[model samples]
Target: MAMGIHKFSKRRGRGARAPMAEINVTPLVDVMLVLLVIFMVTAPLMKAGIPITLPDSRAKPLDQTPKQVTITMNAEGRVFLDDDELSPGELAERVGSLPRGADGAMPLVTLRADKALEYGRVVGVMGELNRAGITAISLVTVAGGAPAETAKKP
Candidate 1:
């Protein structure tokens, strides 16, 4: 009788320990779901930028991000570097004088010209960008910001 009582206690102890070994995944799942929601809400708002009408082009998109110099040309032919106003000659000199990449390559230059600017001004900027040794030039444009989108009756 005594031996049987001891055996029963041991079995109960084993069962209690075994339940502890089962992982509690509920909390982990909850944390992951919260993180997912946070990223989704902030993703679109992060994409909004300085409002400028970009010219349309049929060229395939380039793969440059986080490391390109932006040169903005307003309707009055005023140039800016990420908001710092500069003349075309000053832009070329500043871009040319910057340090090269890790691979000893020239920096990529992106030109963001307003749609109302003259073609000749944009062309001149590109010519200067090339002269500054920035051969990898890309024209920046806002995707799908057409006049038809605003003309809708809502």
Candidate 2:
């Protein structure tokens, strides 16, 4: 009887430990690390502009201008005005409706076309922009691999 009572008390004492008042931060930290890695892996894929391989150019980059408009053309000849897809006719109308700058001049247009597209298709888009009274146009291109000195030698 004495041994039974002692065993019962020992079991009770072992089970009566204080409830945990602190959270386990290890699991939380692990989860947060996983989420951070997922975001890092996906961040580059989340770029906002249209994905197209730009033509390479040796020309220097232009200075940043205020109130500039961007137009993108894909290899399929599809046109987009800042991510909104538009037909050729709709593109012209939308470009025409854009508000003029503070100086009463049309905003500078930046055109980005896929390197695989035909010259005629690019020209057609430019013609639309020109018709919309946008005279200041800049062609967007990726910097070429050739160094300045090497390019100058050609």
Q: Tell me each candidate's TM-score.
A: 0.60, 0.63
Worst 10 residues of 2 by lDDT: 145-154
Candidate 2 per-residue lDDT, tens place, 66-139, comes to: 78888999888899998899975887889999998778888889999998999999999999988888777899
The parts of candidate 1 lying over 4 Å away from their true place are: 1-49, 142-154
Note the Cα lDDT for every prediction shown.
0.76, 0.84
Highest lDDT model number: 2
Poorly placed runs, candidate 2 (over 4 Å): 1-48, 146-154
lDDT of 2: 0.84
Residues 29-82 of candidate 1: C-alpha lDDT, one tens digit per residue:
999999999999999777425556677654666775666677888878888876
User: Clash pairs of candidate 1?
Assistant: none
Clashes of each: 0, 0
